[model samples]
Target: MAEPLEIGSLQIRNVSKIFGTFKAVSDVSLNVQKGEFLTLLGPSGSGKTTLLMMLAGFLDVSEGDIALDGASIAGVPAEKRNFGMVFQGYALFPHMNVRDNIGYALSVRNRAVAEIEACVDEMLDLVQLQQFADRKPGQLSGGQQQRVALARALCFAPPVLLLDEPLGALDKKLRVEVQEQLKVIHRRIGTTFIYVTHDQEEALSMSDRIVIMRDGAIEQVGTPKELYERPKNKFTASFLGKSNFIHHNDKVYALRPEKIDLIVGVDHQDARMNGTVSSITYFGSMQRVIVDTKEGQKIEIDIDVWRNANEVKLGDAVDLLWADEAAVELQMG
Candidate 1:
């Protein structure tokens, strides 16, 4: 069995990236724990990719420093950082077969030919691509090609692995399959993984901790459940998932769509509002109901399809009920 990596934590302190007049990343400080899967999540122009590039030693920092363990690696070259990078495009060499592609990194380091072959074989097995060892990139499917890329990146067992939207190119079903594979691989190798993506579900499902960024600055950082259930601000609440903002007692509060319950009869709870069923969208297993309240506020309720016993219809009057603790007060930004 291959030994798990002794990966050390990464410390990024007051890091910034500048492109002429544009500040792509600004004053970001974060700690990525050892052997943890940390994801940097944000929308376009949010500077997530730029930050990952700095971590990979591909981009020069405009200010501040990045250190692995206790040593500063701010001036280290990309090749000298000993980090593996997997890009969205899966940049595999078409001329090389799977075995050769996976073995390329070891060969470049001038390892013995037998050792390179053994490591390549181990990587192929790790990614479950052993059968396709002789197939070139042109002969493999997109997912298979990506596996080859991942295998190549891991053949030398780098301390850290960086992925920038590595599964973004695949279709939804294929993307999900690859995600499972990635999680499995991470567990087996126990290396530090810093992934970058804008997909909320992806970050929620895969990350040990997620760092949300906006406009080149850090917005919030927390575990997926914490970020989803107790977001720090309006931007995080709305961006991480669907949220309903309601004004009550002259204060704005955020509530999750799934937390609101809809009742067909008269309202009894103090936190109840009367609304018309404006729309209902049926997803498999669950459904979303949008209601236009009499107070001129729109509310959304998400419930299991089977639990929607009221069978509400469009134009029907309904009561939207939620507990007091379900509503999280938001700070105006």
Candidate 2:
């Protein structure tokens, strides 16, 4: 078992970052619980990285304070804050072997030789990299180098770990494998994890809670299911997953493609609309059906591959039905 590290809550109080007249992050306040896996998710230029840099003490806050366990750490230097960071590029020294790379943090702090060795061993085991301990970084693959970076960051047993798209460098298959290992490592060590990613699928799959940012402000924050099923605004609805917006009674409502069903005959459904099938695209297990409705809206529906063009032809009139509860009312400004 690895040594248990102290973890605590982090509070960001009305934080903002400014580069000249433009606000990179605007009046953001959030609370992160101890040992929780919180993700900051957004598209490019959404200020997620700026916010993370402020939290890491690498960038000064333009307004408000950052507190760790009720004490302010905004004025502290990045190195003195006792936090670990892993970047997307896997910033490992090329000359150092795996064991030396993992032990560098401890050595910098002047820890005893025996203590550093023990900690390096524990970290190598934690990341399943013991066999590659003697190999230099140049000899390892991308995935292996990333694992080494993670082990190096965690070997010091920091209270919090900040990852800036650490898995973005790997291929799809290796990325998925590393993602599973990351979850396992987090569960085993119970450290507070703050991850930043633009990939919606990754955020949905890995985060305990997700904060979505847009134009330097938070659009919404919730669990994956909450964000997917009930979005507070149209941007949140569309960004988190596929959504079809319907204007009803001068109000905008969002419905997911999977929630809307296609009807051939008069079947019981809460709400129904008539439209012509504009297009059909095939996926392995599912098919995407696009329909042009009489209401001047193009609706997209996802159905099982078992029900395809054999039953519904292009330009054929069909009924799109869904439950009233399936439509989520949105507050669009």
lDDT of 2 by residue, 1-333 (tens): 265656658999999999999999999999999889999999989999999998888999999999998899999999898788888798899999999999999999999999999999999888888999999999999999999999998888888899999999999999999999999999999999999999998999999999999988899999999999999998999889899999889999999998888876433354378788999888878888999988888999998877554587788888888888999999976
Model 2: weakest 10-residue lDDT segment is 263-272
How much is 74 displaced in model 1, in angstroms? 0.8
Candidate 2 segments whose C-alpha is farther than 4 A from its true place: 1-3, 265-271, 306-310
| Best candidate (score: TM-score) | 1
Task: For each of the candidates, give the backbone clash count.
Answer: 0, 0
Error of 2 at 94 (Å): 1.5
Give lDDT tens digits, candidate 1, residues 210-329: 999999999999999989888878899999998999887777788999889888755656547887899988887888888998889888889788866648888888888888888998
Segments of candidate 1 deviating more than 4 angstroms: none
Which pairs of residues clash in candidate 2, taking residues 3 or more apart in a chain or in different chains? none
Per-prediction TM-score, please?
0.97, 0.96
